[model samples]
Target: MTQKTFLVTGAAGFIGYHTSERLLARGDKVVGLDNLNSYYDVRLKESRLARLQQHENFRFIKCDLADKAGMEQVFRQHQFDVVINLAAQAGVRYSLTNPHAYTDSNVTGFLNVLEGVRHSGVPHLVFASTSSIYGANTKQPFSETQNVDHPLTLYAATKKANEVMAHSYAHLFDFAVTGLRFFTVYGPWGRPDMALFLFTKGILEGKPIDVFNHGDMVRDFTYVDDIVTGVVAAADNPPEGDKNWDGDEPNPATSYAKYRVFNIGNNKPVKLMEFIEAIEESVGKKAIKNLMPIQPGDVPSTCADVSALEKAVGFKPDTSVKVGVENFVRWYREYYRV
Candidate 1:
């Protein structure tokens, strides 16, 4: 692939930082953008940004996605070949308390991204979606073709809105758009709020770790590198409009326009208790488990059908939970000096 200038939103974020790093490593010019909000740890976000700054080809832009003028200015200034949007108000439980944040960032902010890309004529717009959109559905290994009309949480709803929003823009503006539904992404420099980070911290600190759903939950824990691989591949291969797409028998994953959505995840689903055990082994400490009932707006399981992604990109996330957990543990120890 030829070197291309790219714009990566949420550059300070976990997945965003990793994706930007990969692009920079491959001799691509990257303009990394993030508001660096205190949604989690601002320090962690800053650290990620600092690393990206070390690359001469990478430029950091501290801008909020919701700022229409700022976003428009960014598009006007930079000639980005591809735009990867990973910025959003993340966390399902947090969405329950802070509902408006979801709309502000995921809905309105995503609209700004779409509009910017539309006007700038960016060939491909690849954005992050989530498996949470598969809420209330009992289907094993959620597929892109399934109807995601019933999102349990506001966050999921916002992401579902983003998918439709991108589809509309692709149809009206004639641009390629790919939405990646990431599943339980975790690895080095992972979010502190996520299960792996939280579990490691709590285990090392001798604190009781909360295990929801009575430790019966299952997640298709995808490694960040694997997720990034799928993301970059999707960016490299822009979707052509589905020629066989029928209006009467509509497929939710693809459209007649240049739009598509794929589930990029480890096809293997690991049990919650097994994941906790891996953390315990990695940290060499036992966790005092506070098994609790499944919280509202939370699902018992999430398994992604990655066939579409593999067929498209010739790659699939196959990282084992044991190895991924060990990598995270090593990073946690060194980063926090634990």
Candidate 2:
């Protein structure tokens, strides 16, 4: 394989850091960009970056995606073969109170990324979209072909906006663009805000864990390693314009332009209570469950149809929830000295 120089936004982020590590492991040069905002524990972000810094092939940039001038300068400085965008104001419930953050990061920040990729002549731009965009759809397994016009939260809306924005850029600029709709991702070095981390911490501390929707929620919990595998594969194989694409019966997942969307998920949906049980088993402690009603902007379930990703990249996420949760618990214990 030819060595390629890649730029990954949110390199300090969970998925971004893992993706960069994968690229570097393959002897590719990676320039990781992140603002390291206070959305979560900044120490965790720094720790992730520290691990990346140990690699000679890795470079770090302290920049936000919304910073147009800074983004332009970075693009001018580096000749990236591919740009994988994973940075965003993430969280469905958080979007309810802090709505502007989503617009700034997901919407405007994404615009900056698109402009950077466009001007830099980057061949492939693989960005992170969310399964949350499948909001309000009662489909058993969420597919990229389904209509995602009815997003329940502001965060999902912004991500949905990103899909259309990238498509427009692909049509006008003729660049290869692929959007990946990620399911619930968890693993070692996972985000503290995610359920696995929260449940683990709460269980170990003998604190009550918030069981949302009366513990009736279902999620396609994907491991970060599997997510990174799909991401790298997509980056390596950029989408080509679909020649058989028809305008009359246009598909939401593909187009006549060089743009496509694929769902990267574990395909298996596990119940919320079952996930908590896995955590409890891993921690050797049962959680004090505080059953609560479903919060606003929250969905009852999320299951992905990853057939398109498998067809495109010859891979799909197959990690089981039990194994994935155990991995997270192991990491959490070591990281927090529990």
Candidate 3:
């Protein structure tokens, strides 16, 4: 593969940090951008950015995705071979209460990113989508071709918006744009609001952890490293215009233009209890569970059909839950000195 300069949005974020590191490791120039919002703990984001700063090929810029002028200026100054956008306001349950935040970051911020790519003439743009867009579709294993018209939460709606928005740009600007619907990703330096992080913290602190839906939920929990690998592979192989795409019976995953969507997931759904058990085994302690009804803006199950991803990128996420949880627990212990 040829080396090139890449622009990574949300470089201080969990997935963004990992993605930028992978690009730099492969002898690519990386310019990382982030707003460093206090949505979670800013300290955690800072720590992740600190590690990336150590890389000679990595450069950091503190900028919000919603800042139109700043975004345009950056694009004008730097010529990016590919734009990997991983920044957004993330959180499903939180969106229920703070709905405006979702639109501000996911919608407005995303528009800024699209405009930057458009004006800069970036050939390929790979962005982060979510499996939550499956919404009310009661399919066993969600595929990219499934209808995602019914989104259960504001966060899901915003992500679905991004997919369509990018598709339009791909058609009009004639740029190769790919959207990745990432499943439940967890690993070292993971987000604090994610299930594994909360569960591990509660168990270690001897506090009762809330088990929603009476522990009936199932998820395709993907490891972060595996997700990063899949992301890099997708970035390297931008989607070309599908010559065989039929307009009469359209496929939601791909268009006649240089646009496509793929799911990057573990493919194996793990029960809520089974996932908790893995964390328990890693921590050597049982969690104090408070079983409760399912909260609003949440689903009971989610699985991914990553066949399209494999066909396009020649790779799929295969990390087991046991191994992923162990890695997180080990990292958590060291990071917090638990």
Candidate 4:
């Protein structure tokens, strides 16, 4: 396979930074795009960007996906062979307070991406979906075949909508699109709003860590390295249209169009208390747990069924939560001089 030029949206973000760095290490040219919104600490995002700037193959542009003209210009100027859309208004709880962010970034912004791919003749478009889309479903391990019609939060809804939107473009324009449903991703350089980062920070500061769902929750936390590996593999192996796909019994995982969805997770759901213990072990400090009820739009648990991803890519996420947490804590301590 030819090493193609890749465009990774949200390249300043945790997952995006890792993905872009890996691509650069492989000698692939990468055009990274980000708006650098103040949803979290801009300093952290800048810090991430600083690391990527060291790589010779990485070229970054400050732009939002919602900017149709800017996105169109990028598509027109660069002959992007693959586009990995990771930019979005992330967080289930944040959706409750800021619904417009989802609409503008996830919905409107995503539409612009589709337009770019449709016009630019890009072969594959791999975008980030979320496990939160499995909302209101009581399934043990969420499968790609399951119907994701019931989303509890605007964030989940936007992701679910992205899958549908991508499918439509694939059918209409013959573009290869794959939507990756990432389970709770964590590691060094992870978002501050995420659990592992928040818990580690609070524990180090001798502050109380908010334990949602009264510490009864579980998360299939995938490490950042594993996620980028899966993502790059998916980007290289674009989905072909299911020739034998039956319209009567539609399969959500694969379609008659060049579209598919796969869950990228550890496939091992760890309890919230266990996760906290892992952090405590890594940091050598016990967290002051402030037990609280489940917040609005927050799911109690998430476990991904990554068999399909394994079958497609011949790989699965194998990073243990303990190791992942330890790495984060180590980086945190060094980064903050704690």
User: Which has the greatest lDDT?
Assistant: 1
Report lDDT (CA) for all predictions: 0.95, 0.93, 0.94, 0.93
TM-score of each: 0.99, 0.99, 0.99, 0.99
Candidate 1: Cα lDDT at 206 = 99
Q: Mark the regions of model 4 whose C-alpha exceeds 4 Å error after superposition.
A: none
lDDT of 4 at 327: 92
- Please give the RMSD of candidate 2 to the true structure: 0.7
**Per-residue lDDT of model 4, residues 1-338, tens digit only:** 45779999999999999999999998899999999999999999999999999988889999998898999999999999999999998988888889999999999999999999989899999999999999999887999999889999999999999999999999999999999999999999999999998999999999999999899999998999999999999998999999999999999899999999999999999999999999999889899999999998888889999999899998677788888899999999999899
Clashing pairs in 3: none
- For candidate 4, what is the lDDT? 0.93
Which is better, 3 or 4, measured by lDDT?
A: 3
Q: lDDT value for candidate 1?
A: 0.95
In candidate 3, which residue ranges exceed 4 Å CA deviation?
none
For model 1, what is the error of residue 248's alpha carbon versus the real structure, in angstroms, after optimal superposition? 0.5
| Candidate 1: Cα lDDT at 193 | 94
